[model samples]
Target chain A: MQAYRTLTRRELARYFLTSTGYIIIAAVTFLIGFSFVVLLLKLQQDSTLMPVTELFYITPFFWLILLLAPPVITMRLFALEKFSGTFETLMTTPVSDLQVVLAKFTAALIFYVVMWLPLLGCVLIVRHYTSDPAALDAGALGTTFLGIVLLGCLFISLGCCASALTRSQGVAAMLSLMLSVSLFLLSFLAKELPGTSSWQAQALGFFSLVEQMHDFARGIIDTRPMVLYLSLTAFFLFLTLRAVESRRWK
Target chain B: MRNGLMIQVANLTKRYAGHTAVSNISFTVERGEIVGLLGPNGAGKSTTMRILACFLPGTSGTVRIAGLDVFHQSDEVRRRIGYMPENNPLHLDMRVREYLKFRARLKGLSRKQSRGRGDIVMEQCGITDVSRRIIGQLSKGYRQRVGLADALVNEPELLILDEPTIGLDPNQIRSVRQLIKGLAGNHTVLISTHILPEAEMTCNRMVIMYEGRIMAAGTSENLQRLMSNTNQVIAEIAAPLADLNECWAQTAEIQQFDVSPAEGEYFRCALTARNGLDLRPIVYSLARERGWYLRELTLTRYSLEDIYVHVTRPDEEKEEGA
Candidate 1:
C-alpha cells in the first residue's frame, strides 16, 4: 500500500511538472467552452422550449473531442520513459510492474478529473437559463458524469497499453488515437447493418460507448455499462502490465 | 553459496534469436570488493551487467545477488542491487534533488526516508551544489554524478555501474575514482570499462571479457604474471645486423631475434626471450664485447592491452578459420 501510494504521488508530480499536463487541460477546457457557446447559440435559434435539453442533446458531440484528447495526454505515460532511457531505472527499482502501471493509470485519471472540472461551467450555464430549473434531471447529470469518468478511465488505460507497445511516443499516440476512434465509430457501423434487433443491439452496444452514454443521459443508472467500462479498463491495464514485463525477455 | 560472496553466477547465458549475446560464463564477486569488467565494444559486458541488475533476464543459468535468486525473487534482488546503465538516461526536466527523491520513493522508501537518503546520496556523489538545478542544464560530469546518486539512493548492497566514467574529463575521472575507492569497505561495486589504467587504479580485482565469455579473472598482478612468457627485450646497438642476429642466436635463452634498420649504422633488434629470463644484461655484455655502441637495452613488460589482445586473438583466428 505504501509503495502504491509513493508511486502514484511521484507519477502525479511528474505529470504536473511537465508541460504535457498543462497543455492537455488547457486544450480540453477551451474545446468544452467553445462547444458550450456553440450549443447556447444554436438553442437560442432553434429551440422553443428548454435549452438544457438541447445542451444535453448536443453534449454527445463533445465526446468526439474527448475521445481525441486523452491519447495526446496519456500516450506518453510509459512510452516517453522507454524512449528516454528512464525505463531501465524504473525497472531496476524494487517496485513491481503492476504498481508502476496502476500508479500511472491513477495519475492520468486524476488529471482527467481536473480537466473535466473546468467544463462544469457548461452545466452551470444550463441550470441558470432553464425556467423550470427544478425539472432538470439531477440523476441524469450525475450518471453522465459517472459515464464520462468511466470513458476517460477506459481511454487512459488503452493509451497506456499503446504506450507500452513501443518506445516512440509519436507511434504510441498514433496507435492509441486510431484505436479510440475505431471503437467510437464501431457502434454507428453496427447500427446500419441489418440483423435481428437483439443481435444488432448487442453488436451496436459493443461499439457504442454512447449506448452506455444514453442510459446515463436518460437518468437510468444501469449496471451493465458500468461493468463493461470497468472490464475494458481492467483488460487494457493488464495489457500494459504485461507489455512492461515482456521487456525483460527482450 | 560461499560465506563472503556478495554475488555469484554459474554458467549464465543469454541468447537472442538463437545467437548468443552472452555465452556460458561464471564468476563470483566478494563483499566489499571493487571488480572491473573490462572488454571492448560489443563484448557482452553490458548484457552481463544487465542480467545481474535483473533488468534483462538470462536465457539460462542462475544469478544470485546478496543470497537472493535474481529470476525468482527479482524484486528482492532489485532492492539489494543498484544499476547505472551505459547511457545515463535521466529526466532532464527534473531538478537533481527531486529526481533523487523520486528514485528513492520508487525504491519503496518513505517520505522522510526518501528525503534523508536523497540528501546523503547527493552529498556522497558530490552533487549537493546542483541539487536545485534542472538536470538538462548541468554538465556531463554533473549528470553522471546525478545518475550515480540515483543509483545509490536506495542504499543498495551491490552497485553495478556500466561504463560510469565514459564521458568525463581527467579531473572528473580522478574524483570519481577517488569516490569509488572511498566506498571500498561499504559497497561491493562492479564497474565495466575499456580503459585499462582506470581499471588498474580503481578495481581490487579484474575480469577480462571477450566475445561474451570470461577470458581471464584475477588481480592485475596475476594477469601480468600469467602472460609473463610473452615478455620481450628491445636492444638498440650500433653494430652490423648480421652480428646482432648471430649474437642473439648464440644465446640459448633467446628464442628468436628480428633485426630492423634504425638510423645510419645502427640496428634495433627485438629479441623474444624465454620465460622468466632477463636478456638485458646479456645483450649489454655482448654489445661491449663486440665494441658495439649500445644506445638502449630494455625489457618490455606485458600490459593490459597485450593480455586483452592475446586472449581475444585466438577467438578471432578461430572465427576466420571457420
Candidate 2:
C-alpha cells in the first residue's frame, strides 16, 4: 500500500514537473471554452428543446478533448520507464506488478479529472449569467461528471495498456490514440448503420458510451451503463497487468 | 542464510530466443565477501547478477539468496538485495533526495525509516550538497553516485553491482572503488568487471567467466598458483650465445631459454622454469661457474593478466576454428 502511494505520487508529480501536464491542461481548457461559445450561440439561434447540460457533452470539441487527452496523459507511464531503463530497477523492488499498474492507472485517471475541471467552471459561468434555476439542475450536472469520471477510467486504462506494450512514447501515444478512437467510433455503429436488427441495436446500445453520456447529461443514471463502464475499466486494467507481467518472460 | 552462504546458484542457465546467455554455470558467495565476477563483455556476468537480484529467473536452475528460493520467495529475496545494474539507470527528472526516498519506500521501508535512510545514504555517497539538484542536470559522476545511494538506502544485506566503475574517469573510478571497498564486511558485494586490475584491487575473491562458463575461481594468489606452472627468469650476462645455451641445457629446471645480443659484450638471456621454480639462483650459479659477467637477474611470476588470458584463450581459438 505504501509502495503504491509513493509510486502514484511520483507518477502524478511527473505529469506536472514536465511541460506535458500544463500543455494538456491548456489545450483542454481552450477546447472547452471554444465548445462553450459555439454551443451557447447555437442554442440562442435554434431555440433547441435540449437542456444546456445535455448540449455541453455532444459537441465535437468535447469529443476531441475526450479522444486526445488520455493518450497524451498516459503514454509516458510505462514507456518512459522502459526507455530510461528504470523499469528493471522498479520491478526488482519489493512491489508487485499489480501495484505498479494501479499506481499508473490511478495517477492518469486523476490527471484526466483535473483536465476536465474547466468544463465545470464553464457550466457554472452559464448558470451565473442566465440566473435560471432550471439551468443549474444539480442532479444532471452530478450525473454528467460521474459519467465523465467513469469514461475517463476506461480510456485511461486503455492508454495504460497501450503504453505497457511498447518502449517508445511516440509509439505508445499513437497506439493508444488508435485504440481509444476506434472504441469511440464503435459506440456509434448502431446509429450509423440503417440495417441493424433489434438485437444488434440493443447490444450496440449496451456498449455505446455516447448514449451513456447523453443519458447522464439528462439526469438518467441507469445502473446498467454504470456497470458496463466499470466492467470495461476493470477489463482494460487486467490487460495492463498482464502486459506488465509479460516483461518478465521476455 | 544457510551456513553463512549469501548467494548460491546451481547449474544456472539463461537461453534467449536464439542463444544461450548463461549455460549451466554454478557459483556461490559467502556472507560479507566482496567477490568479483570478472569477465569480458557478453560473458553473462550481468545475466548472473540479474538472476541473483531476482530481476529475472533462469531457464532451469535454482538460485537461493540468504537461503530463500529466488523464484518462490522473490519478495523476501528482493528485500535483501540492492542491485545497481549496468549503466546505473536512474530517473533523470527527480531530485536526488526524492529519488532515494522513493526507492527506500519501495523497498519496504517505513516513511520515517525511508527518510532517515535516505539522508544516511546520501551522506555516505557524498551527495548531500546536491540533494536538491535535479538529476538530469547533474554530471555523469554525480548521477552514478545517486544510483549508488539508491542501492544503499535500504541497507541491504547483499549488493549486486554490475560494472560499477564503467564509463568513469580515473579519479571517479578510484573514489567509487573506495566507496565499494568501504562497504565490505557489512554487506556481501557481488561486483562484475572486465578490468583485470580492478578485480585484483577490490575483490578478495574472483570468479572469472568466459563464454558462459566458469573459467576459474579463487583469490589472486590462489588463481595464479592454480592456473600457471611456468615462471620466467631474465638474466643480462656478458657471454657467448653457445655457452649460454649450453649452461641452460645443463640445468634441468630450465625448460626453455631465449638469447639476444644486448650491448657490445652483454647478452640478454630469458629462461623459463618448468614448474614455477625460481631460476634466479640457478642462472646466477651457472654464470659464476662459467666466469661469465652477470649484470642482472630477476624472476617474474604469473600476473593476473597472464592467468586471465591463459583461461580465455581456448575459447577465442575455438570460435575462430568454428
Candidate 3:
C-alpha cells in the first residue's frame, strides 16, 4: 500500500509538472467550455422547452473532446519512461509491476476527471442565468458525472495500454487515438444499425457508448454501461501491467 | 552457499531472440568485496549485471544475491541491491532531491527515513549542492552523480554499477573511483567496465569476459602469475645484429629470442624468458663483455591488458606465434 501510494504520488507529480500535461488539459478544458456554451446557446435559441444541460451532455462536440483527451493525456505516461529508459530503473525498484501500472493509470484517470470538471461550469452558467429554481436536475447531473468518470477510465486505460506498447510518445498517441476512435465508431454503428428492437441490437447496444451517454443524460440509472466500461477498463489495465512486466523477458 | 558470499551466479545464461548474449558462466563476490566485470562492448557484462540486479530474467541457471534467488525471489533480491545501470537513466524533469526521495520511498523507506536517507546519499555522492536542480539541467557529471545517489538512497547491501565512469573526464573519474573505493567496507560493489585500467584501479578482483564467455577471473597478480610463462624480456641493443644474436642465444634463461632488423645499427630484440628467471643480469654482463651499447633492456611484466589479451587472444594468433 505504501509503495502504491508513493508511485501514485510520483506519477501525479510527473503529469502536473510536465508542459504537455498542462497543455492537453488546458486544450480539452477550452474545447469543452466552448462546446458547452455553443450547444447551450444553440439549443436555447432553437427550442426553449428542451433542457440545455441535457443537450450539451449528449453533444458530439463534447464527446469528440472526450475521445481526444485520453490519447493526448496518456501518451506520455509509460511511453516517455520507456523512451528515456527510466522504466527499467523504476521496475528494478522494490515495487511490483502492478503497482507501477496502477499508479500511472490512476494518475491519468485523475487528470481525466480534472479535464471534465470544466464542463460542470455549463451547469453553473445555466443556474446563474435561469430565474427558475428547479431548472437544474441534480440527479441527472450526478449520473452524468458517473457516466463520464466510468467512460474516462475505459479510455484512459486503453490509452495507457497503447503507451506501454511503444517507446515513442507520438506513436503511442496515434495508437490511442486510433483505438478510441474505432471503439467510438463501432459502438455508434452498433447503435445506428438495423433492427433496434431485437435482442441482437440490445447485445450490440451494450457496447454502444453513445446509447450509454443518451441514457446517462436522461438520468437513467442503468448498470449495463457501467458494467461494460468497468470490465473493459480492467481488461486494458491488465494489459498495461503485462506490458510493464514484459521488459523482464525481452 | 558460502557463509559470507554476497553474490553467486552459476551457469547463468541469457538468450535474446536467436543468439545467446551470456553463455554458461559462473562467479562469486564475497561480502564487502569490490569485483569488476571487465569485458569489451557486447561481451555480456551488462546482461550478467542485469540478471543479478533482477532487471532481466536469466534464461537458465541460478543467481543468488545476498542469499535470495534472483529469478524466484526477485523482489526480495531487488530490495538488497543498489543498481546503477548503464547510461544512468533518470527522470530528467525531476529535481535531484525529489528523485532520490521518490526512490527511497519506493524502496519502502518511511517518509522521515526517506528524507534523511535522501540527504545522506546526496551528500555521499557530492550532489548536495545541486539537490534542487532539475535532473536534465544538470551536467552529465552531476546527472551521473544523481544516478549514483539514487542507487545509494536505499542503503542496500549490494551495489551494482555498470560503467559508472564510462564517459567522465579525468577529475570526475577519479572522484567516482574514490567514492567506489570508499564503499568497499560498507557495500559489495560489482562494477562492469570495458576500460581495463579502470578495472585495474578500482576493482579488488576482476572477471575478464570475451565473446559472451568468461576468459579468466582473479586479481591482477593472480592473472599475471597464471600467465607467468609468457613473460618476455625486450631489449634494444646497439651492436652488430650477429653479436646480439649470439649473445641472446648463449643466455641459458632465454627460452626463445626474436631479433628484428632496424633502420640503424641497432637490433630490437625480444627474448622470451623462463618462468621466475631474472635475465637482466645476464644481458647486462653480455653487453659489457662485447662492449655493446645497450639502448633499452626491460622485463615486460604482464599487466591486466596483457593478461586480458593473452586469455582472450584467438587460437590462430597463438598458433601463428608458435
Candidate 4:
C-alpha cells in the first residue's frame, strides 16, 4: 500500500514538474471556457426563451471538451518514462506492474477531473439565467457530472493503454485520439443504423457514449451505462498492466 | 538478507529474436564482495545485470539473489538489491530530494525511515547541497550522484551499478569510485565497466566478459598471469647488428629475436623469453662479451590492458576469419 501511494504521488508530481502538464491544463481550460461562452451566447440570441439550461446540456462543446481532455493529459504517463530510460529503474523497484498502471491511471483521472472543472462554472451560469428557478434541473447537472466521471475514467484508461503500447508521447496521444474519435463516431452511427429503432437499438445504445450523455443530460441516471463504462475502464486498465509487464520479454 | 551468497547463477542465457545477448554462462558473488564486470560494448554485461536485478528472466537458466530465486521470488529479490541501470536514468523533472523520497518509499521504507535514509544517502553521495535542485537542471555529474543516492536509499544488501561512471569527468569519476570503494565492506557491489583502471582501482575481483561469456574472473594480477608465462624483452643496442648477433646465443629460456634496425646507429631487438625469465642481465653479460653498447634493455610486465586484449583476442581472430 505504501509503495502504491508513493508511486501514485510521484506519478501525480510528474505532471506539475514539466511544462507539458501546465500546457495540458491550460489548453483544456481554455477550450472548455471558450465553448461554454459560445453556448451561452448561442442561447441568449433566441427570441422564444430557448432555455439556456437546455443549451448547456445539448451543446457538442461539452462532449468535445470531454473528448479532448484525456489523451493530452495521459499521453506522457508511460511513454515518457520509456523514452527517458526511467522505465527500467521503475520496474526494478519494489512496486508491481499492476500498481504502476493504477497509479498512472489515477493521476490521469485526477488531471482529467481538474480539466473538467470549467463545466461547473457553465452549470452555475445556466442556473443563474433561468426565469423559473425550479426549471433549472439541478438533478440533471448532478447526473451530467456523474457521466463525466465515468467517461473520464474510461478515456484516461484508454490513453494509458495507448501510452504503454508506444515510447513516443506524440504517437501515444495520436493513437488515443484516433481510438476516442472512432468510438464517438461509432456511438453516433449506432443511432442512425437501420433496424436499430427497436429493442436492439436500446441494447446498442449502451455502447454508445453519446447516447448515454444525451440520456444523462436529460436527467436519466441509468445503471446500465454506468456499468458499461466501469467495465470497459477495468478492461483497458488490465491491458495497460499487460503492456507494462511485456517490457521484460525483450 | 545478508547471511549467505549475494548472487548465484547457472547457465544463464538471454536470447532476442535472432541472436543471443547472453550465452550459457555461470558465476557467483560471495557476501560482502566488490566485483567488476569488464567488457566491451554489447558484451552482455548490462544484459546480465538486468537479469540479476530481476528486470528480465533468463531464457534458460536460474538466478538466485540472497538465496531467493529471481524468477519466482522477484519481490523478495528486489527488496534485497538496488539496481542503477546503464545510462543512470532518472526523472529529470524531479528535485533530487523528491526523487529520493519517492524511491525510498517504493523500496518499502516507512515515512520516517524514508526521510532519515534519504538524508543519509544524500550526504553519502555528496549531493546534499543539490537536494533541493531539480535533476534536469543539474550537471551530468550531479545526476550520477543522485542516481547513486537513489540506489543507496534503502540500504540494500546488494548493489548493482551498470557503468555508473560512464559519462563523468575525471574528477567525478574519482569521486564515484571513492564512493563505491567506501561501500565495499558493507554492501556487495557488482559494477560493470569497460574501463580497466576502474576495475583495477576499485574492484576486489574482475570478471572479463567477451561475446556473452566470462573469459576470466579473479584479482587483476591473477588474470594478468593467465596471459602468458613467457615475457617479452626489448633490447636497444647502439652497437652494430652483426656484433650484437655474434654475441647472442640461444639458451634454454631465451630464443629467437625479432630485430628491427633503427635509422640511427641503434638496433631494436625483441625476444620472447620463456618461463618468465629476466633476460636483461643475460643480455648485459652478452653485450659486455662483445663490448656492445647496451643503450636500453627493459622487460615489461603485463597490465590489465594487455590481459584484456589477450583474453578477448580469440573472438577477434574468429571475426576476421568469418
Candidate 5:
C-alpha cells in the first residue's frame, strides 16, 4: 500500500509537470463547455419545461472527452517509461508490477476527474438558469456523473493496457483509440447483424459503455449497467497488469 | 557462502530463439569488492548484469544474492541490489530530489527514511546543488550522477552499474570514478564497461569476457603476468640500421627486432626479448661500445587493452601457436 501510494504520487507529479496534462484538461473542458452551450441554446429555443433533459442529452459529449483525453494522458504511462529506459529501473525496484500499473491508472483517473470539473460547473450553470430549479431531476444528474466517471476509469484502464504493449506512444494511442471505438460501436454492430444472435446482443449490450450511459442519462440508476461498467474497468485493469508482467519475461 | 561472497552465479544461461546471450557463465563477487565485467560489444556483459540485478530472468541456471535464489526470491534479491543501467532511466520532468525520493520509496524505504536517504544520496553523488533542478535541464554528467543517486537511495548491499561513466567527459569521468572508488569498502559493486581504462582504474578484480563466456578472471596483476613472459624493449639509438642489426643478431637475447627510421641520425627499434631475459644493460653497453647516442631506453609492460585483445582475439589459436 505504501509503495502504491508513493508511485501514485510521483506519477501524478510527473503528469502535472508535463504539457500533456494541461493540454488534456484544457481540451476536454473547452469541448464539453462548448457542447453545453449548444445544448442550452437549443433548449432555450424549444422552451422546454424540463431544462435538465437537455443537460442529460448533453451527457454523450462527455464520452468524446472520455475517449480522447484518456488515450492522450495514459498512452505515455508505460510507453514513456520504456522509451526513457525507466522500465528496467522500475522492474529492478522492490515494487511489484501490479503496483506500477495501478499507480499509473490512478494518476490518469485523477486527471480524468479534474477534466470533468469544468463540466460539473456547466451543470451548476444549467441549474442556476432554470426558472424552477427544484424541478430539475437530481437523480438523473447524479447517475450521469457516475456513469461518466465509470466510463473514464474504464477508458484509462484500456489505454494503460495498450501502453503496456509497446514502447511507442503513438502506437499505444492508436491502439487504445481502436479498442475504445470498437467497444463503443459493438452494440450498433450487433443490432445490424441478423439471426438469433441473442448472445452477441447481450455481450455487446453489456460491454457497450455508451449504451450504459443512455440508461443513466434517462434518469435510471439500473444495477446492471453499473455492475457492467465496474466489471469492464476491472477486466481491462487486470489485462494491463498481465501485459506489464509479460514484459519482464521478454 | 562465506562472509565476503555477496552474489554467486552458476551455469547462468539466457537464450533468445536459440541464440544465447549469456551462455553458462559463472562467477561470484565477494563483499566490499569492485569487480569489472569487461567485454566487447554484444559479448553479453549487460545481459549478465541485468540477470544479476533480477531485471531479467535467465533461461536456466542459479543466481543467488545474499543467499537467496534470484528466480524464486526475486523480491528479496531486488531489495539487496541497486541497478543503474547503461541508459539513465529517469523522469526528466521531475526535480532531482523528488525523483530520488520516489525511487527510495519504491525500494521500500519509509516516507521519512526516503526523505533522509534522498538527501544523503544526493549529497554523496554531488548533485545536491541541483536537487531542485528538473532532470531534463541537467547535463548528461549530472543526469548520470542522479541515476547513481537513485540507485544508491536504498543503500543496498550490492551495486550493479552498466557502463556508469560511459558518456561523461574527462573531468566528469574522473569525479564519478572517484565516487565509485570512495565506495570501495561499503558496497560490493559489479560494473560493466567496454572502456578498459575505466575498469583498470576503478575495479579491484576484473572478468574478461568474449563470445558470452569468461575468457579470464583475476586481479589486474595476475592478468598482466599472463603476458609478462614475452618482454618488449623500445630503444632509441643514434646509429644506422646495418650497425644495429649487426649488434642485435649477435645478441642471443634479441628474439626479433623491428626498426623504424627516426629523425636525422636516430632510429627507434622495438625489440622482443627472449623469455625471462633482461636486455636493458646489454643494449646500453652495445650502444656505449658503438658510441651510439642513446636517446631513450625503456621496457614496456602489458596493459589491460593488450590482455583484452590477446584473450578475445579472433585468431586465438594462431596467436597462441606463434
Candidate 6:
C-alpha cells in the first residue's frame, strides 16, 4: 500500500514537472476551446435547441482529443522506464507487479481527467455568456463528464498495456493510437450497418462509444455501458500486469 | 539463518530461446563478506546477479537470500537486498533527494525512517551537496553516486552492486572502492567487475565465471595457487638468445621459458619453475657460470589477471579445437 502510494505520487508529479505533460494539456485545451468556438458558430447558423455541453461532444475536435490524449499521456509510463533501465531497479524493489501497474494506470487516468477539465471551463464560459442555466443542464453535464471519465479509464488502460509491451515510447504511442482508432471505428461500424434493430447491431451498439456518449449527453446512466467500461478497464489493467510480469521470463 | 549465509544458489540455470545464459552455476556468500563476481562481458555475470536480485527467474534450481527462497518469497527476499544494476539506471527527471526518498518509501520504509535513512545514505555516498539537483543534469559520477545512495537507502542486509566503479575516473573509482570496502562487515556485498585489479582490491573472495559457468571460486591468492604451483623468474642477460634458451631448457627447475630481446645485445628470459621454488638464484648462477653478464633478476608471483586468463584460457582453446 505504501509502495503504491509513493509510485502513484511520483508518477503524477512527473506529468506536471515535465514539458511533455504540459504539451499534452496545452494541445487538449486548444482543441476543446476550438471545439467551443465552432459549436457557437454552428449554434448561430442553425439555431438548434441543443445544450452547449451536449453539442460539444458531437464535435470532431472532442473525439480527436479523446483519441490522441491518452496515448501521449501513457506512452512513457512503462516504455521510458524500460528504455532507461529503471524498470529493473523498480521491479527489484519490494513492490508487487499489480501495485506498479495500478499506480501507473491511476496516474495516467488522473492526468487524462485533468486534461479534460478545460472542457468544463469552456462549458462554464458558455453558461456565463448565455445567462441561461438550461443551456448547461446540471444532470446532463454530470452524466457527460462521468462518461468522459469512464472512457478515459478504458483508453488509458489500453495505452498502459501498449506501453508495457515495448521499450520505445514512439511505438507505444503509435500502437495505442491504432488501437483507440480501431475502437472508435466500432461506433462507425454500428451506425453504417443496415439493421438498427438486428441482434448484431445491438451487440455492436453495446461497444459503441458514440451511442454511450449520446445517451450520457441526454442524462441517461445505463448500468450496461457502465459495467462494460469498468470491466474493460479492469481487463486491460490485468493485461498490463501480465505484460510487466513478462520481464521475469526474459 | 542457514549458518549465516547471505546468498546461496544451487544448480541455477537460465535458458533463453536459443541459448543458456547461466548454466548450473552455484556459489554461496557468507554474511559480511565482500564477494566479487569477476568475468568478461557475456560471461553470465549480470544474468546470475539478476536472478539473485529476483529481477529474472532461473529455469531450474533455487536461489535463497537470507535463507528465503528467491522465486517463491521474492518480496521478502527483496526487502533484504539492495541491488545497483549495471549502468545504474535512475529517474533522471527527479532530484537526488526526492529520488532517494521515493526509493526508500518503495522499499517499505516509514515516512520518518525514509527521511532519516535517505539523508544518511546521501551523506554516506557523498552526494549531499547535489541532493537538490536534478539527476539528468548531474555529472556521470554524481549520478552514479545517487544510484548508490538509493540502493543503500533501505538499509538492506545484502548489497548487490554490478560494476559499481565502471566508467569512472581513477579518483572516482578509488573513492567508490573505499565506500564499498567500508560497507564490508556491516552488509554483505556481491559486486561484479571484469577488471581483475578491481576484484583483487575490493573483494574478499571472487567467483570467476566464463561462458555462463563458474570456472573458479576462491580468494585471489587461492586462485593464484590453484592455477599453478610455479612462480615466474625474469632475468635480463647479455647473451645469445639460442644459448640462453638451450641452457634454461636443460635446467630441471625451469619448466617453461621464453626469451625476448631486452635491449642492444641483451635478452630478457622469463622462466617458470617446476615447483614453487624461487628461480632468481638458479638463473643468476647459470648466467655467472656461463660467463654471461646478468643485469636484472627477479622472482614475481602471478597476478590476478594472469590467473584469470590462465583459468579462462583453456576453455577457449578447447572450444576452438572442437
Against the true structure, whose lDDT is highest?
A: 6
Report how far off residue A248 is in candidate 4 (Å): 2.6
RMSD of 3: 2.8
i-RMSD of model 3 (Å, 1 decimal): 1.2
Model 1, chain A: how large is the TM-score? 0.90
Q: In model 3, what are the clashing residue pairs, if there are any?
A: none
Q: How would you order the candidates by DockQ, starting with the best?
A: 6, 4, 3, 1, 2, 5
- Candidate 2 per-residue lDDT, tens place, B35-68, comes to 9999889999999988888878899889999999
- Where's the lowest-lDDT run of ten residues in candidate 3 chain A? A43-52
lDDT of 1 at A115: 83
Docking class of 1: medium
Write down the lDDT that model 1 would get: 0.85
The DockQ figures for the candidates are: 0.72, 0.69, 0.73, 0.76, 0.66, 0.85
- Chain B alone vs. reference chain B, TM-score for every model: 0.92, 0.92, 0.91, 0.92, 0.91, 0.95
Positional deviation of residue B134's Cα in model 1 after best superposition, in angstroms = 1.1
What RMSD does each model have against the real structure? 2.4, 2.6, 2.8, 2.6, 3.0, 1.8
Global lDDT of model 2: 0.89
Q: Taking the tens digit of each residue's C-alpha lDDT, what string does model 1 give over A160-205?
A: 9999999888999999999998888887887777763777667676
- Model 1 agreement with the true structure over B1-322: per-residue lDDT tens digits: 3248898999999998868889999999999999999999988999999999988999999999988899899989999888999878998988999989888887888889999999999999999999999999999989998988888888889999999899899998988888888887789999999999999899999999988899999998899998887668998888777777778888998888889989988888989888768888888887788899998888887888888888878978988999
Per-residue lDDT value at A130 in model 6 = 81
DockQ measured for candidate 3: 0.73
Best by DockQ: 6
On the 0 to 100 scale, the lDDT of residue A100 in model 3 is 84
Better of 4 and 6 by DockQ: 6
Q: Write the per-residue lDDT of candidate 6 for residues B1-322, one digit (tens) a residue.
A: 4248999999999999999989999899999999999999999999999999999999999999999999999999999999999999999889998999999999999999999999999999999999899999998888888988888999889999999989999999998999999999889999999988999999999999999999999998788788567688888899887898789889999889999998799998888988778888888788889899999888777789888898789978998999
Residue B248, model 2: lDDT of 82
Clashes of each: 0, 0, 0, 0, 1, 0
Give the higher-TM-score candidate: 5 or 6.
Answer: 6
